[model samples]
Target chain A: AQSVTQLDSQVPVFEEAPVELRCNYSSSVSVYLFWYVQYPNQGLQLLLKYLSGSTLVKGINGFEAEFNKSQTSFHLRKPSVHISDTAEYFCAVSDFLCGGTASKLTFGTGTRLQVTL
Target chain B: SAVISQKPSRDICQRGTSLTIQCQVDSQVTMMFWYRQQPGQSLTLIATANQGSEATYESGFVIDKFPISRPNLTFSTLTVSNMSPEDSSIYLCSASGPGGYTFGSGTRLTVV
Candidate 1:
């Protein structure tokens, strides 16, 4: 079983300021990490994923996340944030045991990012 | 990634009634999942919509309350039966593809 823990419940930042959302996980086996963003009343959008190879993965909308194997962490970071970036961010993990058939994702409690101008 | 679509973006229903939510993906997907998001909460997996077989429900969910059907690769539906005010939530469907998973816009169900 895999579990994700997002450190912060809310993060408020001024526009153009850098922000980092912390995430940690506990899994006995190797797992895949993902970050998703949800706008108000909207579906989740994939921000980025760490499958293999790259520890630092770049994603759309100028967002990125680094996977730390030893720390069991995958934290999302952006050099600068915009008002449009204000949303609920979720950290998820999927264990590789199910042959990916049971690709059930365990998500952390979301962190609401509020970008103020 | 696949482009997923869900029907009835928002619906208001009376208590004890049932509502069927639809999910369609542009391409054939190997796996599809249904999830529920309560007010101000994280998503919880409802079931796995397996093609040509019964949906594997999660621990707290049941087949009778939330029935799912996956006749083919690109389409699936979940019917919330005998719904109550507690059943009101955002139902989302996600499909797994080459890159990763893609989610539908979600169906907001409000039970009165």
Candidate 2:
């Protein structure tokens, strides 16, 4: 069974300040990593995904993440964040399943990014 | 990416009442997924619905409690049966697309 762990449950940062949201996953085989953001009372929006190659993956809203295979981490980062970036971010993992067509996602508990003035 | 349309954005239901959530996709998809997000928790996959096959449910979920139907490649529905306050959560539907995975806006269910 695969699982994702987000170390930070809540991260408060001042607007225009850089921020990093840590994410880690545990899987026996190679897995695909992803970041998703959910605004208040809204559904999830995909931020970025790591399928193959390119450890440094860029996402929307100037967000990016590095896929560290050695450390089993895919941490999301931003050089600067806006007030609109305040939302719940989730880290998910999916692996290629042999004889299975569906790419099931296992998600983390989510990190709430609170951008303040 | 495929667009998913979910109905009844939010609903307040009484205990023991059932609620059915519908999802419609703009394009045909091979796999459709249903997930649940409890208050202040992560999303948990409820089941997988494929056309012309029975829905496959995850652990801690059952067909009796969460009956699913995938009538076609672009449409599916999930019914929360015998609902209670514990069933209050946001139900989301998603589909795999050529670009990536897309999710519906989700249905917020509040049982009282």
Candidate 3:
């Protein structure tokens, strides 16, 4: 079983300012980490994923996240945010055990990002 | 990437009624999943629908309340029975392939 925890419920920042959304997970086995974004009246869109090899993962819309094994954290960051960047962000995890292709995602509660001008 | 098309983008139904949501995938996939997102909450897995087999539902969800159908590899349906205020939420369907997991736009059900 895998679970994800997003530290922030909401984050408010000015346009062009930097922001970081923290996420942590708990699982007994090796896992795949992912970040998804949901806009108003829309479905979830994949941002990035950390399956293997790279700890620093870059996503669309100039967003990036780093996977930390020791801390059990995968935090999303952006150097600059726009008003259109305002949306709900979710962190998810799926078990990556050998030949265990479940594809069932365990998601965080979500963090609402609000960018102001 | 798999393109999922979900019907009934949104609906306002009367209590005690039932609604069936449909999901159509562009490509044939082995597994399709149903999920629910309550007001201001995270996504919860409802069930896993597999072709030629009964859906495997998660705990707290049962076949009586939510029935799933997977007649083929490209299509599936989820019927929400006995609607109530608690059933008001967004229902989403998803599929995974070599590209990644892709989700439908979602159906917003409001039980009044």
Candidate 4:
């Protein structure tokens, strides 16, 4: 079983400012990492995923995340944020033993991003 | 990624009543998952619905309380039975493909 932890519960940033959302995980085996964004009353949208062969992964809406094996972390970053970027972000992990099934996603407590103008 | 459609978007039901949520995927998927998100909390896996077999439920969830049916690769349903105020939450369905995992617009259930 894998578990994910999102360090911040809420982050407030000014529009156009850079932002980072920290995430960490604990797993005994190799796992796939993912980031998902959810707008209010909407479904979760995949931002990016770290499967293999790349430490830095870019995602939709100008977002990116890095997978650091030693740190057991996959933190999401954006050079600049917009009001539209304000939403709840979730970090998830899935054990490869599950055959890449999305149902295996172990999500972290969400971090709410608030972008202000 | 697959496109998923879920309904009814939101509903308020009386306590002791049940609600059934449906999900449809545009493409065939091997696995469909049900999730629950309580107020101010992260999403928790409810069950994994696989065609031609019984749904695999996670710990703390049971088939009697949350029955699931996946008759085909593109469709699945989750029924919440014997509902209570504590059962009120956002129910989401998700599917996975080579592209990535895609989630349906969640169904918000409010039990009163």
Off by over 4 Å in 2: A97-100
Decide which is better by DockQ, 3 or 4. 4
lDDT for each residue of candidate 3 in A20-114, tens digit (9 for 90 to 100): 99999998988789999999878899999888888999999999999999999999999999999999999999875223135688899999999
TM-score per model over all chains: 0.96, 0.96, 0.96, 0.95
**For model 4, what is the alpha-carbon lDDT of residue A44?**
84
TM-score per candidate for chain A alone: 0.95, 0.95, 0.95, 0.94
Q: Cα RMSD (Å) per model?
A: 1.5, 1.7, 1.5, 1.6
Which residue pairs overlap in candidate 4's backbone?
none
Write candidate 1's Cα lDDT for A1-117 as tens digits.
Answer: 899999899999999999999999999888888999999877898899988897999999999999999999999999999999999999999876233254688889899999999
Q: Which ten residues in a row have the lowest lDDT in candidate 2 chain B?
A: B94-103
| Tens-digit per-residue lDDT, A1-117, candidate 4 | 789999899999999999999999999988889999998777788899998888999999999999999999999999999999989999998876243355377899999999999
Q: What's the CA error at residue B112 for candidate 2, in Å?
A: 1.5
Q: After best superposition, candidate 4 residue A16: deviation in angstroms?
A: 1.8
Candidate 1 lDDT over B8-38, as tens digits, reads 8999999999999999899888689999999
Clashing pairs in 3: none
Interface RMSD of each: 2.9, 3.5, 3.0, 2.8
Task: Candidate 3: list runs displaced more than 4 Å.
Answer: A97-100
* Predictions in order: lDDT: 0.91, 0.92, 0.92, 0.91
Which of candidates 1 and 2 reaches a greater lDDT? 2
Native contact recovery (fnat) for each candidate is: 0.44, 0.53, 0.44, 0.56
| DockQ comparison, 2 vs 4, better candidate | 4
